[model samples]
Target chain A: MRLLINKIFLALSILSAGVGLAFLAWILITLFMKGLSSFHFSLFLNDLIEGGLRNLIVGQMILAGLASLIGIPLGMTAGIYIQEYGQGRYAALIRDLSDIMMSAPSIVIGAFVYAIVVVPMGGTSGFAGAIALAIMMIPVVINTTDSMLSLVPRELREAGIALGASKYKVIIDIVIKAAKVGIMTGILLAFARIIGETAPLLFTSETSNYFSLNLGESFPSLTVSIYDLANEPEESSRDLAWAASFILTVLVLIINLTGRFITRNKK
Target chain B: MEKIFQKLSLSSATLVFVLLIGIFITLYSAAKPAIDEFGLHFIINPDWNKEIVVETPSLRADTVANDAEDDAIADEDDMILDEDDDEMLLDDEDDTVTKTIYGGLVPIVGTLLTTIIALTFALPIAMGIAVFLAEIAPKNISYVVGIAIELLAAIPSIIFGMWGLYYFAPIVADLVGGYQVSLLTAGLVLGVMILPFMAAITRDSMNTTPAVLKESAYALGATKFEVIKDIIFPYSKVGIIGSIILALGRALGETMAVAFLIGSIFVLPKAINDPTISIPVAMANNFGEASGLGESALFYLALILFIISFAVISLAKFYFLKKAK
Candidate 1:
């Protein structure tokens, strides 16, 4: 009876994990099956279809790219300050707030951008969207930076100090070099997250139907366009939504896999 | 030089505070027009017309005409004055809009309801998996299972939303009843979305239960089930709860999946099976249609969502911090 119970418990766990994997498999399969059906070179080259995602892909890359550039530096600096500089009440407050912001809903960030950037600047623009995405990216990068820096043995920092290196030099030369891969992973993950975000971009980046590279103009992203198409009245729009979603899924999977590979390789 | 570096660090730390303040200032200014018109009532009520009167002269004229009609129908002069007073009351209704600061109660309620339902379905299965992974499963199978569960966390929300829309919603609608889009479908999909988070966290937490404790239970001739119930669970309760809270936070903030499945009706629903819009869904639903006051209303909705999620996240952080300490 005891052996039977243990077997039953083990079987249930396998089944539970299997169920989770099945869901993941289903998502990938569905995307590939539908997305591949509409996949074409023209889909990528075209500007945008009324309720399509051509412009959205370009816009997402630009916005997400710009956000990472801004976020990575600030986050690294803040992380260095927290991990290397002595912890004080102020540092504690900043760290706590960073965590809070990290967990804040992406849409709230959108609303925040809407209030601060979009409204004052007078419309939805890619610049505003990038700033909003950057805000979302900051906490993640900061956390990663701090964690990575802390993993550098204290002896290494002390050795640098003994060599008469400046604090900034020590951070730049020894600490950062040590944690480069981890920091890169963090940045990549942040990029993945920002790209996947549809809610925040929905308001700050006004949905556009066509492709335009002008930063001041409104633009749609792949996620937002997928959302728009999915909700539209047309069957073709729905198919386009599936195609966009499939492409997005592929992009996210590649990023995740790449991040995992880099981390594993570093280890 | 040391003082300068310290000062620079202080300023940098202060800069983070400045960014947070910047966020607040922006939210305040964007919300100001609606707040100015609606006042504190914006927190209590759901009036989206706070600035429509200002934006459209025709709307103001219509309001005045409606008030005049109410005034003419009254019998007493005092009552007519009272009817004018009632327009004042109607103006006070505008105060409700002011007070309604995006009365996120409905959306907050919807988010909590959906999260709770998802948790109810996810926890047992997750715990079962965690237990098997940590204690019961063969090493080879456990490795495969673990990798598979972790991969689930990699799937983006958009894919989840798409799949939920086309595939899961239909199956759920079929199994439960008709093809109605409901909270149940949302919760079900969200459960799937969060299963990996719950399972992974639970497995890690349960793994921390010292082998000695389980061994002691087993040494007493306790069955595997008995050891799990009495030894493993009690030890990992706080961590398990922490994991659940973290998963709950994710559920609260999930946008696309819930938006696709929940059939985004704005009003509060009567049952789990009924269509209801969550706060995140409210933001998504309004993002496309919002213009003018409708836009501000959406931002306000977004603000409300941020606050709700902020509260949940803070709580989870606090719990995890306490557990870590």
Candidate 2:
């Protein structure tokens, strides 16, 4: 009876793993097939009426760039504070609260930004959307940076302090330098993540039809455009969504795979 | 200057705490009016008229501006104004209804039910994969499989929605009683989306289960399966459970995939194929034009979802801490 149960368990494990991999392949293949066929060269051009993707791509860049600008610095600094200087009940509180924030439903972050920024301003804007994504990015960066900084050898910090260097100097010069690659990987993953987010921008950015540099107005993003277009009744609009999804999926996969490679190489 | 740097670092950490408090403040203050008006009935009462899904744009932007012409269609789903109770204020001059009575029971129920279904599909399969990667597979195969799992996770929720809605839903529609977009479809896609999360943490904990413990079991004449069941699984059980709870949190808050695949309607599903919408999906679909009571009610729903996520995550954290100790 025991031998039979063991054999059955082994068969079930292999079968489930196979099912998981098969689903992965199906999702990717379907995405690539429809996405590639829907693709058009005009997508990269900046014509206003035909609904080109130039504005969408540029909008994603501006939004993600601004978000990273705010999120990376705050996240890295907070991470350093937690890993290097966090102590007692205070540090423990920060650590736990941040973990909760990380797990908080991301759509709620959209609601929070909408309540704070969009309602007061009378409408959605690129600034509000960027701030929402930055909020999502911070917890990820903090988690990664804190873990990476903790990985840096304690002897390095001790040696620097013993050599009469200030704590800040030792941290900046030795600790951050050692953990630079890991920190970059974290930022990359965070970037890849917020770039594909649709919910936060659904009401916050509110979607734009044309390319506009005004941070005061609603903006176009690849993901939001995909959301709007996918819901439309028109075939052309649906194709546009597919093309955008293809690009977004390919970009995210590349970033993630690169991060994985870097980590594996290091270990 | 160096001392100032220290101060800056400490203050930055303090900023994270302030941000958390600020989210709570803004969310609570925004939801307060609705909470005061509706009380516990907001979650339990299932009589949602137009405020449940709000499909038409007559509610868009300024409902007051469009009320005259839009009132005809708006009344199709809403009878609160038509009922004309003495409780209603009855804007005699403008003829505009001031409030849309809101209850989120359907979406809230849908969110929990779908997440439960997703976990049911995801947990055992995810555990099976973790066992294979941790103990059964060779190192090279495990490494390749592991990276593939990470890539599976990297595909965003929206893309999963796209694939599931267009490709997978049609194929399974007959199986799900002819409704293309149903709770089962959403749960299946969500199970796929969260598989990596459950498996990754489980695999890591299993990998770290102190090889000597497994070796001793083997040396005592145990089979491979017996060793895994007796030593490795028992050791990593807490971490495995923690990962499942964390994945449950992810499944609960899932928006785009559930939105696209669940037929984008707020209904108490009576069958496997009945159309439904989760809280996050309902919030996403209706948030754009929501105003007055509708806006605050939406905020209240978001707060409820946030609280659920908070409690689930904290539970997982406790499990993790205990496991670490």
Candidate 3:
């Protein structure tokens, strides 16, 4: 009876696992089919008014890059602090607070930004949007960086300290260097997380009809455009949304795969 | 200078603490106007209207007043019904809908329903995949599957929303033989979106289980299933629960994708296929046009979401920090 039950359990586990994979496959297949069916070479070059997605693609890159520039440094510092100096009463509190901020809804962060930056500025801007996305980015970076730094063995830190190196030098030279690949992976993952963020951009960037690199003005972003285009009644608009989705999905896929490569410890 | 550098790091970490307090301050300050006008009833009421008069929550207990209001409401409802029977159509123009409005019951109910439905669908699949990759599969295969599963997490919530709106919702609608974009569709998309986080947490917890425990179980003539059930789950209860809370936070605050697939119906539903709009989605879709109380009310929704997710995230952080220690 135990053998029979075990066999049944194994079958059930495998079957459920297949369902997970199948669902993932189905989503990708449908996305590819719809996106590619409407996709043409011109889809990459034509403007939104003329029915294309190139501008939004460019906009997403600019937004992600800016957000990363702001978030990566702040996040890494917090990460380093938590691992190195965040040991007592205050640091523990900071650690908890960071986790709360990390889990707070992206939309709430957007609304918060809307009040502080957008409302005060009297209009939405790409810079405000970048800050919102950066807020979302920081917690992820801190978490990943904290864990990655921890993975740098204790002996390495001890060795550096024994050599009369300052704690700062020990971290910069030994710890960070040791955890380079993991830190890189964390940064990449943080970038990937914010790139597809729509809620933060909604109220802050406020969606421009045209491509604008000016941080003072409203900007086009892939997720926001996808939101706008998906809701449209036109076939061309829906097709544009599909292509954008495909691109975003593929981009994230590549980054995540690269992250996997970097974090893969052969030893 | 090095001391300054160290101080900078400490202050930077402290900045996140300041940020958490800042979120509540900003939201509450923005929402204070609407909250003052509606009192606590702002949350307890379901109607959200522009031109409608609102009944105070105190009057809810007065049967005589309620009967008078109900009679007046019925007469007004009959008048509106004579003009149009469709609830959604009646909702389009603000002046035409009934009075006693500016309630959040619908969005609150919708948010909970969609999140619960999402958790229901995601938990099983997440656990199964986690079990496979963590315990059952060969090392190489597990590594590949693990990476692929993490890739699923990397896909932005917006893409899921777009796909759900353009592709997934239609198929589900077809399967149910109902209209596209409803509560069920939104929930399913959320389910798929949250699977990675929950599975990743469970897998981590599973990874920490001592090999010796499983081996001893096996030596005692226990089956693989018996070992997992008896040893793995019992040991990882906190982590498993922590992941569930994390997934709940993600689902509760999920905006773009849920907004797209959920049909933006403000009315609470009695059926799975009924249209609904969650709190985050409410803010997403309407904040652009919102003014005065309408705008502050959206902030109120954000405030509620913030508080709830704050508690959930705290529990999750507790578990996660324990693991780190």
Candidate 4:
């Protein structure tokens, strides 16, 4: 009876793992079938207004890129302060709060941005969307930077100090250099996470039909557009949503894999 | 130079604190109008976007007497009773006041029910997968499978939403005999979305158990199940619970996945498969055209969601996971 129970437990565990793999396979296969059916080279070349996705693709890059610009610097510096400068209660407090912020509802962050940025500006803009994404990215970046910086040996920082380097210089020159690859990978993962975000951009940037470079205006967002298109009554719109979803999944997966690959290669 | 750089980094760290407080204040003030209008009753009141015609004695003496103390509260109570029969309150001598009231009970209940359903569905599969990865599988197989699971987590949630709607929901509806988009389908899809995430974290926690403990259990004539149940599970229980709560927090705020499947409507779900709206779905769908008190009500919902998630995550992180760390 005991042996039977053990065998049954093992079988059940394997079956659960199989269930997880099956869902992934099912979703990917469906994505390929539906997405590829609608996919065309022209879909990339033309704007959404022209029955294509050029505008949204470019626009999403700009939003995520701008978010990285804002988030990486602020988050890294905050992380540096947490891991290096501070020693006791305050550092721990910041670390704890940053972790909490990492899990705060993304839509609340969007609402917060909408109230502060969009409301004050009197309209939704690319800037509001980027700011929302940046808020989401900051905590993730801080997490990676804090953990990555912690992994750097004390001996390395001591060596720089022994060589007469100032505290900030040692941190900037040596400590940062040592943790560069890890931080970069973390940032890449952070970018991938935010690039696929839909909720935060729903009302902030509020996706435009036409491509506009102006940050002051409503910007095109691929994820938000997918939500909108999928909900539309038209079958063509639903097909377009699938195609957009496929591109988005491919992009996010590639970035995610590249981040993991970089760390693996380094190890 | 050192001082300047230190100040710069210190201020940046301070920004995180500032942002958290800012989000609270911003949501509170934005939600202020609805909070003031509905008081605490908004949470319990199920009526959303409900307009009622209230009649009061038009005599100046009667109106003046009613306005003496607690005017808004008294008037709202009258409005609630007259909601079903607006015409009954219509009289030539009586002044009719039209008021639109919004309440959060439907979406809040909907959110909690769906989350409960999701947790119920995901908890077992996640535990099983974690056990497989941590103990049963060979290291190489575990490594590849772990990566595959993480990749599932990396897929954008909107894809989950769309796929759930188009492909998954129909099969679910066929089995359960309900609307394609429903609380059940949404919760199940959400379960699928969070499964890999929960499994990966649970696996990490399980892997934290020392080899010696498991080896000792095995040496003592323990089977694989015995070793896991006695050694690994007891050792990693807190971490596993923490992971589950963390997944709970994630599911609570999940928008895109639930939005596609939840059939965005403000009715109370009478059955497991009934179509209803969650707080996030309500905000996602209505934020565009909503104005005045309607918009404020959405912010009110946002504020509640933020606070609930904030408390839930803090409990998981500061209480449960802290010991694990």
| Comparison by lDDT, 1 against 3, better one | 3
Q: What is the per-residue lDDT of model 1 for residues A1-267, given as tens digits with 9 covering 90 to 100?
A: 877887686677668656666776787788888889977767777766643466888889998998888777777777778787847776777888888788776777787777778878888898888888888888888888888888989999999999998887787889899999998988887788788888788778866777778889787678877887787888888888888877887787688778878999977
What RMSD, rounded to one decimal, does every model reach? 5.8, 6.1, 5.1, 1.7
Which lDDT tens digits does candidate 3 get at residues A29-141? 98889878877878678667677777788888898899999899899999999999778888777777877788889999999999999999999999999999999999999
Q: Pick the candidate with the highest lDDT.
A: 4
Error of 3 at B300 (Å): 0.4
State the fnat of candidate 3 relative to the true structure. 0.78
Distance from true location, Cα of A267 in model 3, Å: 4.6
| Fraction of native A-B contacts kept, per candidate | 0.50, 0.73, 0.78, 0.83
Candidate 1 Cα lDDT to native: 0.74
| lDDT, model 2, position B186 | 88
User: Residue by residue across B1-325, what tens digits does model 2's lDDT show?
Assistant: 7878877777877878988898888989999988876677689756554422223234456655675555345445444444644333333323333445678898898898889888898888898899999988899999999888877787878988988888888888866565888888888888888988888878887887898998898899887789888898788878877888888998999898888888877678998777888889988988887778788988899989988898899998875735654
> B102-155 in candidate 3: lDDT tens per residue?
668888988998999999999999998888888789999998877777787777
Interface RMSD for model 4 amounts to 0.7
Candidate 3 chain B, run of 10 with poorest lDDT:
B50-59
DockQ of each: 0.51, 0.71, 0.71, 0.88
Docking band of candidate 1: medium
TM-score of each: 0.85, 0.91, 0.90, 0.97
**Candidate 1 Cα errors over 4 Å, as ranges:** A1-8, A50-54, B1-13, B32-105, B139-141, B211-223, B287-300
Mark the regions of model 3 whose C-alpha exceeds 4 Å error after superposition.
A265-267, B54-101, B319-325
Q: Model 2: runs farther than 4 Å from truth?
A: A47-49, B50-99
TM-score of A-chain in each prediction?
A: 0.94, 0.96, 0.95, 0.99
Winning model by DockQ: 4
